[model samples]
Target: MEMSELTALLTPEGLRLLDALGTVETTDAAARAVSTLRAAGHGPDLVAAVVGQAHLRAKARTKFGEFASRMLFTRAGLEQATRLSVAARHAGRLRTAGITHVADLGCGIGGDSLAFAGAGLRVTAVDADEITAALTAFNLAPFGDDATVLHSTAETADLTGIDAVWLDPARRTAGHSETRRVAATDYSPSLDWAFDLATRMPVGIKLGPGHDRDQLPAESEAQWVSVDGSVVELVLWSGALARPGVHRAAMVVRGGHTHELTAPADSEDAPVRELGAFLHEPDGAVIRARLIGDVARHLEAGMLDEHIAYLTSDAALTSPFVQSFRVREVLPVTPKAISAALRAGEIGTLEIKKRGVDIDPATFRKKLTLRGPNAATLILARVGSKRHAILADRVDAA
Candidate 1:
């Protein structure tokens, strides 16, 4: 949302209209709402703002749940905001540390701030962008005096009264609607500054899950989190927020339940062996946290290939940390041969999962010309020196 649109939306009239409008999720609904509102003598800017917000609120339910209905968003802010479930976990760390006040630097749309305040802690939320800060203030207005919203850069935010820091630096270009990711070196309130702050205070630093591990501070606890199979973010905890003797952590959240795997440091890879009855694809968080060996031992598994992350086990075991697949049979890697095998199996829908290969699953799925009354997952991988396609049935996580 632009400053002009935001200015119009701040009016009492605009907020009421946005709430009354419900959800304009479809293009047709948005268009119709705009026309009807304009026809009712509403200004174009107000009409646009409320309609846009309605769409964003509907989409944001995936992250903020019902809170989004009463909140506002910028396309970029919503994209970068942490999920409520994950943010609550972050707040739990602060609560456990007995920190009562938190300074949330770069508080995009106040997502984490909401979690903090909801946990009964006072929140000081800061954002560099003026429009975002204003929107954040409005979103957090419900918390009243408990939440302080600031339109200041992280460097300028006063933290004297704070107990801990939650710094999520802007990792994208400055914009309301359309924005692109900036390089790590270009992050606002640079990582260097953030890490320096970490050394002195209890801090939780959120970064992209794929952040260079070697660049992370040696003393901090690095944790990778995934939600329902999608790796979300990497968090570095220092001071009171860091767990003792725990250096690498993988937190997997599925169906609102969480299971965590932690190690003192990255674990060595399990020895390689031939394909077994079950193939385990470790969760992305597990792979990124470099604790695959811990999970491997838990399942009595070995690396399918020395250089790949896929694991194989003769034991019929599965864990929350991996998506286990019952390997049916290995088929030839050639497109024609693989398609023939799939067709003979009566496969109608295929899920292609690949690692250590250069094939695009979408294009390859089309080439396979799937047809029939069955669905199966195809595992494309390099085992030893050769590439192979393994037909498999997904074994739901226990």
Candidate 2:
């Protein structure tokens, strides 16, 4: 957005019009709303800003919930902004660690700052982008002076009196609508600088979940978090923020419930055993944290294959770290044979899950002629050197 457009949008008149418009659910509705506002004497810039904000606010609801209505966002900032629930977890960790004041470096739209303030911590939120810093200031307005948004690069931010540091470096090119990923070396303030700062003070560094584990600082505690079912981010905690005896951790958040597993070091993989009646699939966070073997050990399970992550056991036990399934039948791996077997079993509404295989679930589903009254999950995976298809029923966690 241009400076002129932003200046206009921050005005009382523009804000009133935007609030009056509320939310524009569809493009057709937005077009009609734009025409109505224009006919009512609103200028073109005001109309455009309000319309754009309406769409962004609607999209922000998934991340900020009701707070999205009161928030202003740039497309790229909103996309990179941490979800309110996830940010709250981060804030909770800081609060529990006795961190009262924090320096939020590269605070995008003040998502983490909002959470920190809400958790009763004084926050100094900094962002290199002027527009983003302005938006963050507006979003954090309710906190008064407790939340301060600064328009400055993280590398230049003065952290003299800050009790803790939270850095979310920009890992992508700057664009509101389109952005491309950049390397960690290209990150704003750079990972090297961030790590150096961590050595001097308690720090929480947020990075992509796929960040190289080999590059992580040995003294920091690395935690991988998954929201719902997708692995979202990897957080490295340094100094006092790093938990004792917790070098690796996986936190799985699903439907408001959180489950965490921590280990001092990577666990060894369980031995490969013959296929059992039950199959278990570890959550993505666990896999990313390399804690799958821990989950397998907890269930007294063994790997389906030496190299694959799939676990099997004779017991029908269930745990939060893994999704368990009860095996019903083992079928041939070929499409024709699998189709005949499924047809013979009168199966329909198939859920295809695969790992260690190159088959696209959508394309493979199209090849199968499924027509039956029954429904089941089909697991396609490699068992050592051979591919096997297992029909199973999902076992819900108790």
Q: Please report the candidate that would top lDDT against the real structure.
A: 1
Compose the digit string of candidate 2's lDDT tens values, residues 16-108. 988988988888888998899899998888888899899889999999999999999988999999999999999999999999999999998
lDDT of each: 0.93, 0.92
Model 1 C-alpha lDDT per residue in residues 1-398, reported as the tens digit of each score: 77889999999999999999997788888999999999999998999999999998989999999888888998889999999999999999899999999999999899999999999999999999999999999988989999999999999889998999999988888888788988999999999999999999999999999999989999999999999999999999999999999999999999999999998999999998889999999999999999999899999999999889999999999999999999988988777988888889899889999988888988888778688999999999988778889999999899
As for model 1, its CA RMSD to the true structure in angstroms is 1.2
TM-score of 1: 0.97
Candidate 1, superposed: residue stretches over 4 Å from native: none
Worst 10 residues of 2 by lDDT: 1-10
Global CA lDDT computed for model 1: 0.93
Candidate 2's error at 113, in angstroms? 0.8
